[model samples]
Target: MSETFDVIVVGSGAAGMTAALRARDLGLQVLVVEKAHKYGGTSATSGGVAWIPNHGLGGSTDTREETLTYLDAVIKEPVNRERLEAYVDTGREMLGWLGGEGINMISMPWPDYFAELPGSRTDRSLVMPPWDGRQLGDKFPLVREQYPRFKLFNRYSMNLEETFTIAARAPGWKKKVATVIGRYWKDRSTRKMTKRDRLYVSGAALIGPLLARLDHKGVKIRLETKLETLITTGDKITGVTVSHLGRIYDIEARHAVVLCAGGFEWNQELRDRFYPVRTSIWWTSTPQGANTGDALIAAEKIGAATEHTAEGWWAPTMILPNRSASNFEEVHQAVFDVGRPYSVCVNRNGDRFVNEACSYDRFGAAMASDQLATGANTPCWLVFDAVFRQKFTAGGILPSAIMSDRSIPMDWWDHYIFKADSVAELARKIDLDPAKLEDVTRRMTEYAAKGEDPEFGRGSTIYDKTFGDPTCQPNPALGAICKAPFYAVQIHLGDLGTKGGLKADHKARVVDGSGNPIPGLYAAGNATGSPFGLNYPGAGGTIGPAMVFGYIAANDIASRATNRDVASAREPVAT
Candidate 1:
């Protein structure tokens, strides 16, 4: 027997949930199937910033013309102008709809990754307000928790403001630290009693309330259900064959099948085929076993067109040995840490390739571009000094209050962290030419002292300074790597996820190779060919488009259904 729903949403991330919720609001029976045990996909572990331009949040003054102009400046060829326009125009409407559903949101003051871009605004991003996990009641356990390393002391989840306050050593730092500890203790007590922490922020906060809303509406979400294939009638998708707990079930979609399943970051074969630089699951920050591009493969099997297959939302990542395994590894994205004072990334030839303070996407892109020339840009070394170790956290290693033998491990120093007492010795340890490395180190030291990086212009922009130490003079990002006992960690090609997938039209409908919409198929989020093409416009670039297109898909499906019902009503009676 086959179960039937007005809409079947594949994947349970922000995109899938948004589609399901919108469909349910339109009086449609919606079913969401997730391959993972938990509901939220990568969105659950993300920072939860939605880059909705001209959203009017935080008194943003962004305009549609400005946004289009910015898109023209950043996005590349094979661009879908219609889809991009739709996203910019309808983004505010989607936010309004979500807000009406009692989902609390606040303006995140983070600037656009490309603040210098024409349409960029500092207050364009919006994030979900902190949520109390206890409100989810029995369902709290099923919600996938954020990665342990992302939290403070693996206990308290801090917001952007709190993170900056502590990192910058702002006024009342002691009081803030005490408050965090106190909250962690309270959370510990709650966890002991109920087996779930109460305070949820970032991605958890974004997803928790949406899940709560879904629960309130009695929406059916089947976890551990993997989509095996799409059941199509001619060129139109009608249903899907899915396997749940080793049991295969055929499910029918009465109106539409929405694919929000993630991209192919975990699939090595696809990475080798599409990516400019070959990558692996070991490098991505996405949730384990979640984004294998199953949906993308399924769509391709039905002749769905794809674009931007060579691109990903890139970020330089460092593997943490303590959290790695044979099949999977935990990756810490080197975002703010790399841009802070006392740090610089160098290729195998011991040369700086890019502005270290730029956005992660640009940083990774620079590394990939450099690899095309020398083939040795990846596995690049992130070199830093004793000052960086004493002042900031990097790759999950926290700053030490007192420098001692116990503070720095012998095994770590010998294996993961290459340490040397001098620049020339550090070059020798890392297999770089002593003269070249020393010269680069000397130049960096000179730049740091002058607070100017004429070579790469580190800390030249507002976005760069956002992650830098405010205490640093002239340039917050530049610092002399002259301190003794310099340290280095291997960084690799990492990403949030691949941006390319099944090509989608303006209505979020999956388009065939001939450029026609496949009747009942739709895709959004990372599962669809990104509307941004090659450019990452803002902080929430991935999630923003994912949500807007998901909403668009739902609205289009709902409108089509209404029109069909109207046509059927006008049909002549059989005589």
Candidate 2:
């Protein structure tokens, strides 16, 4: 006989774990099944910023329509306004709910994706409070492994302690490298320092706080438990088959099944089968354990309709050696933060691409054009002077630190960051038109001297400056390439995960291929086709929606089961 609960959640990514937490809160017995060895999933490996629209949280100016405009610019299809609105509606409400349950939110008012438009406002972006390592107890190892080895800080008060400690000692560029990581490592609320500590806040902060909340409630989190199949009868889902460590088991959810298994970005065959382009490499910044499209597939096998498969959570990336996504946090910071001499970014042809320092989307857009107009997939090249390369850290390009945390593993760059003495020689090593390389250098130098980008126009947008260092002299994008012993590395187009999958109604119930709801089944996070269409409004936006819908699915399931919505409740899919 199979065990059962009120709800069965597959995959413990942010959405899955969050759904389980919310379900338990609604008084539903919940079982969270994860295929990975740990909790966190892709969320563990991501920057923790949740791009949000206007929350009643003080200063956020983000609105529903501006968000839609942001989405339309990058996507290739129709935006499902009805379903998408539900996501927005829940975002503000649930965010407050989670905060009430001990999740900490810091208002930045700044646009996460760095939009400078009229509607763009700061402080609306919610940042999870930094969690104390002492609170995590046994989960500290899980937290450490989840984030790249970073320095610890006051988990709750992001500013009070961290900012004062830094400003008191490491003023100016003397600030620690970790402090330069954007919101990934710092606390944002206390307003302790005059200058914003660029410390980052990613899975460490986002997942950390949520995990802490779930811990407080004693949620049973099982790892290495892969959900195998959905038991259905007469169109209703009754239970799920699960396998762990060679053992098979069944767990029936009396109320519902919430599929939060992340998208199938790591599945090579799936990537090739569904993606528009055919390429050998796919280096999305997703967590290493992100191979669970099972939620989407299982639902589909049972006849769920879908949308948004044409695109994904994508960005431009540097193709480093040993073939991995470039350390973007490092890449962006190096070009803009380290105060290194200006550099120029170019493609394999040695010609310039998008604003080298702009957000990954613009970079991806230019590469997409190159792929469609010219058959180019491997967009490589990073031209830096000796000063820039010496001081700057370009994400995965630089080796990770070993002991004292000052340096990276030697193997990191040995695999990528092709090195040569001169522009012509470097072009030879990367294999591109030599004349084109030199000509690009000549033009870039001229542009840097004049301080303007004639091509893609890098520093033109306010969004461009959001990630750029205010210290650069010439336009951040127009820095001259005059420094000697210049180096260029190859970059690639990467997707965090496919945004396409099973289409679901606002309640997160899977809709059939015929556009009918599949009872007793629901999905959130990437497992369901994105409600955002191709539009990604901000950084944590994907995660924020996932968490919100996860909460909704849980309560809705419990509501129906308890007869709270007696009149509207339909019979379970499988009797």
Candidate 3:
């Protein structure tokens, strides 16, 4: 016998949880199945910002017309106006509903990645307030924690505000440090008893409240349940076949099956098939064994169409040798680390292709574009000076410690960090033309002195300055790499996750090749082609649409169910 549910939500990330919770609110029996041992997929490891336009949470003056206009400018080919409009219209309602359901949220003062674009606002992003993990009790163990690279001191997590406060020597530096240490100690004590970290912030905080709400409603979430395939009855998806503990089970969905199983980031075969160039699974920031394109592969078996398969939420990633005694390498997403002054990214010909201070997504796109054109930007070099080393941390390497540790026996400098006494020498070591690099460095030095980058306009925008050092003279992002002992590291084209998957409509229904909805089937998050196409609008661009579309799918299913009930009631009884 098969267990039945009104809706079966796959993947248990932000999108899956949102769909499940909305279905439960509408008095539907929803079952959430996750392939991983724990809930909270990639969303838990993210920055947890939701780019919700016209939300009014940030007290910004924005309108639907303005937001749509911006979308028109950013989104590329195969634009779905209906889905885009639906996202903008429902984003606020979704956030408001979540807030009413006890999820503490606050408007983030984050500028849009493309602040120069129309309708850009510094107030559209929203993030969760810091949460106490003890509130979750035993359930806290089931929640996926934030990535270790995102934490401070390998034990405590800090948000953007706290991170900047410590980095910039802000007014409350001492208090912030003390508070982080105090919380770490408290968490240590709790770990002894609960075996779980106590204080949750950032991505974990965003997901923790949603999990709490699900627990309150008595929703059944099955972990380590991998979806094998969708059970189709004629043209409609009726159920799913899942494997748990080496046992196969059939779970019937009475109304619909929502696929929030994420994108194909970790799938090498799919990456080779869809990506324009040769890309690897190691380039993504998604957790291991997650986002194997299960939803997309299953949907394709039923004639579901797809779009934007060649694109991703691209970002530059620094490739690091394994610090742990493991054989595999480590890749860290280069966010604010590249935006600090005294640093510049250059292609093989030693030329700056794009503004270094731009968003990571844009920077990656530029790398891809350069690769497509010259076939050389994938392994670009990030060059920085002694001034930047003294002031900022780059690619997880601390300059002060590295410079002082001369007694170490390993050839760490040769394998990872490249150092040279002159710009020409550094160019020679990195296999670049010494004359061209020298000329570029001299021009960059002059621009840094004037606080201007005439070639790319590096630090002229609010978004660029957001990640820059405010104490720097002239431009916060533009600094000449002229000091002795220059350093360089190779960066690759990487991403948070791939943006393409099964094609979905505004109602979050999976659509076929002819652009018709596949009845009883739906997709959200990275499981479907992103409505934004290739443009990443803000900090939380990925999650914001995932959540809004998840909500839309639930409401649409409930409405369909209500209509079916009314239609049956109107039928006459046969004698």
Candidate 4:
């Protein structure tokens, strides 16, 4: 006999889980299925920040008009205005309701990615408070582990605040590090079970609480369950055909089926077909072998339309050589560090292109454009001097004060940061013309001394200076790169995830090619066409809309759904 659910949510990330939880709260029986062995998907590995404008939290003074103006200014592609409006209004409600459900979030003063825009603000991003992983008991092992870059020494994890504090070596940073290590050591009980710490931060923090809440609400999440196809009755998506432990079964959704199975960033065929440029999956920071467009493919087979297939949440990334597994390689996101003092990203021609201190998405877009135009900027070099290395981290290496130049493993020299005694030698090692490289370096040093960037306006915005060194004389973001022992690390255009997939409406209903919502079908997160289009509004831009729309989808279904059970119209085609 087949099982029945009020709602069947595919994928177990924030969007799927939030949809299930919200549906359950509306008195619906929900079943969450995950393709991977663990829950949380990419959300568990992300920074776990949600950007909610006018949230009225942490004294945010954002307004609806301001947010709308800002989105209009920043988002260039065509978007459903209703979805944008719904996000601003419903996002606040989601935050408050989640808090009431015990998912405590603190407002982060992280400025919008486009700080110069009219509607941009500094107080809208929210992050979950760090929680104890031990609270989840044996289920702790079921959650996906955070990326190594988010942890110190690949062991103890730190929240965003602590990460910034220690990275900048700010006041009391020593005490903070000591306290973190101390806490990890004190958790002898957890230590006995596993080397993983008791403290859960970032995406883990948010996911941990959500899992607990789902368990309390009696939500059943089937791990290692793969959705083979959406079982539809006419135009209505009635349920799903899923395979588990080599057994195939039909689970009927009495009301609706929500697809939140994430983007196709990992699928090479999809990337070659849809992505604009830089089609290498190795350049991405998302989880490997996951988010392979399962839901997108299944829905498209059922007549769902896709948009923004060429866009992604662009970011600059460096592929590290130190850590290598059988199939996986370490990728360090150069989001903030490249914006700090004494560094510039240059093409093979040794010319400074975009402002090194611009928002990462913009930086990535610049790289993509430059590469497409010139064909020499795809694999760029982030050039810096010894002084810069001493003050800030580059690639995946820590600051010299902590990791030191001499103590660095010998094998990492060329692969990680190509070290040379002078700018000319560094240029020669990286296959750039020595004279042009030196000329660019000299001009950049002059800009640093003048406290201005006439070429690219490097140190001009609040967004630029957010990760800069305040103690640097004059412009905190500008500093001389004239010191000897120069270093350059290769950077690639990377992304948090692909931002394109199945198109959906303001109410989270998946729309067909003719722009009509498919009955009993819904979608959200990276799996759907991003409501914000190619523009990233602020920190947590990717995950924020995902959670909000997931919440909206559940509510929309609850409002219109009836308790009529539909029999399967036809046999589901087995894959």
The candidate that wins on lDDT is 4
lDDT of 3 at 208: 87
Q: What's the lDDT for residue 7 in model 2?
A: 81
| Higher-ranked by lDDT: 2 or 3 | 3
lDDT of 1 by residue, 254-319 (tens): 889999998989898888989877677788888876799899899899899888888789888887
lDDT tens digits, residue span 1-575, model 2: 45777788887777887798777777666678888786687776665566656566664566767655555554456766677778766777887777777775776544445464444455555666555443565664454233232233213123323532332232353354355344443445423432222222456667766776666665666888887888886778888988999999888878788889888777766677776665433466566545647777777778887777755676645443332433533321122221123566666556665666565654555566666666654454566665455544454444222212234345553345555677777777778787888788787678767767687566666656544434455665456666677666556666666677778888888888777888899998888787767656566766777887888888688778763332222221111
Error of 4 at 98 (Å): 1.2
Candidate 1: segments with Cα more than 4 A from true spot: 187-189, 194-196, 323-329, 402-409, 563-575
**Where in model 3 is the C-alpha error above 4 Å?**
168-171, 187-191, 194-196, 399-409, 562-575
Give stretches of model 2 more than 4 Å off: 61-76, 109-118, 147-201, 280-282, 318-341, 399-415, 563-575
lDDT (10s digit) by residue, model 3, range 1-575 = 35887889998888999998887777777789999998898898888777888786756688898888777777767668889899999988887888778775788888888899887878878788888877878777778887676766556778768877866555787799788777677666686786345777777888888888887777778999999999998889999999999999899998999999999999999999998877778878778769899999998998999988887898777866666643557877776777778888889989889899999999888988899998888888888888887777676565453334353226557566777898888888889998988888788889889999999999999998878877777888888878888888788788889888898999999999999999999999999988888889888899889889999999899988852332322222221
Model 1 alpha-carbon miss at residue 442, Å: 1.2
- Put down candidate 4 lDDT per residue, 1-575, tens digits, no spaces: 26988899999898998998888777777899999998798999999998888788866778888888888899988888898899888988998888878887888878898888898889888889898877888788889989766787779989889999888777888998998788888888888899887788898888899988888777889999998988889889999999999999999998899998899988888988986675588888888889888999999999999988886788888877645442445778888777778888898888778988888888888888888888888789999998888878886777898788887767777866799999999998999999999989888889889999998998888888877888886888888889988999988888889888999989999999999999989998999988888878888988899999999999998888665222221111121
**What local lDDT does model 1 show for residue 101?**
88
Which residue pairs show collisions in model 3? none
Model 2 gets an lDDT of 0.63
Cα deviation of 531, candidate 1, in Å: 1.0
lDDT of candidates 1 onward, in order: 0.83, 0.63, 0.83, 0.85
